[model samples]
Target: MSLSDCRILELPRISDPRGNLTFIESDNHIPFGIDRVYYLYDVPGGAERGGHAHKQLHQLIIAASGSFSVMLDDGTERRTFFLNRSNYGLYICPMIWRELHDFSSGSVCMVLASRKYEEEDYYRDYAEFQEAAEKRG
Candidate 1:
């Protein structure tokens, strides 16, 4: 998929006097089925995560608490998305390189993925990802 396939998705939310609640359903809130779920937390200041691209995985990343920024690179162009709200998610398609950075203190980045862990599905090198993107382009 291209960078154009990446977008921000708003999730369903309910507000009450005490607190707010958010929920996501597979293939309803996101474009794919949920196969894995994970989160990043307690990230030290200036620490960065996700310097890779998935060959076939689709993902929805949400800032469950606090804030962070996601930088997407699609061989020829780049875009940065700032995420702070709990009810919004960033949907990422396959073959796009993503880097998560500028995380606020105690931030939690929750990810709902379309595929389970598969080391062969990852492009951990930017140069390799770029090369593959170019060939596919």
Candidate 2:
């Protein structure tokens, strides 16, 4: 996939004076079926997460609380998205490199994955990921 395949998906939100509620449904709101769910929180300031690409995973990354930036790189192009809203998710297709940084205090990043975590599906090396991405194109 290419960087153009990545985009922000706005979740359904219900606003109220008491509180706000938002929700996501697998295959109903997202483009893929959800197989795993996780989140990142309590990150030390300036600490970065995600410096790899998935070989065959579709992911929807949401800023559950606070704010942060997500950098996505394909073999050919790069884009950065600032995520601060709980109701907006960045949908990342397969074969794209991702890095999360510039986290505000108390930021919580939630992720919905299309597959269970598998060690072999990850491309931790940028050069290797680039080479594979080139081949995929």
Off by over 4 Å in 1: none
The 0-to-1 C-alpha lDDT of every candidate, in the order given, reads 0.97, 0.97
- Predicted candidate 1 versus true structure: per-residue lDDT over 93-114, tens digit per residue: 9999999999999999999999
Residue 68, model 2, lDDT = 98
| lDDT score for residue 57 of model 2 | 98
Candidate 2: tens digits of C-alpha lDDT, residues 19-133: 9999999999999999999999999999999999999999999999999999999988899999999999999999999999999999999999999999999999999999998
Question: Candidate 1 — which pairs collide?
Answer: none
lDDT assessment of candidate 2: 0.97
